[model samples]
Target: MPPQSEVEPYAAIRRDARSGMSGRALERKYNVGRRTVVKAIASAWPQPRKKPPPRPSKLDPFKPVIDEILRKDLDAPRKQRNTVKRIFARLIDEHSMSDVS
Candidate 1:
């Protein structure tokens, strides 16, 4: 579902417009641009935000190594299993992961 923050303004703008509020007035009252006022008047719902494409991470190459460590940890004693600090230490000491912070 779309968030209430995005939906509420659209509903308010449309409602105000139907009650004879001017586009410029709606923009001022709602603190939005002329284009936003136009879109709100045209439709009851706002468009969903665009999702950014996934980018490569510094640890992308080391993911398989981390996964293998985690998989092995499933069989180890709970107290001896890898914590985040241990994982980071292992990445540095064993895998020579110097670039990632």
Candidate 2:
């Protein structure tokens, strides 16, 4: 396979071409292969379908509180930051959440 860096830029070039520009023009401007230009253009040309939102994790209910905790404790030492154990403990003690996972 080509290196990751080269592949990503080629994809971007392809996306740009599909939006309006010709493949030959894109290849000349971006120095990408013609095949790469074609592929990117084809993928982006079609209107993408909307995906449904993912289900929230058990921890998600506590996100607002978690954000508050993080904000308040931003200057605290790393060791004092919330751990998985602490999160589980808080979920059980405060929110009455079960070990769903």
Q: Which predicted model would earn the best TM-score? A: 1
TM-score of each: 0.62, 0.39
| Whole-structure CA lDDT of model 2 | 0.72
| lDDT of each residue in 4-73, candidate 2, tens digit only | 6555665678567658887788888888677767666656443445899997787777778778777867
Best by the lDDT measure: 1
lDDT of all the models against the reference? 0.92, 0.72
Model 1: ten consecutive residues of lowest lDDT: 1-10
Clashes of each: 0, 0
lDDT of 1: 0.92
TM-score of predicted structure 1? 0.62
Task: Flag clash pairs in model 2.
Answer: none
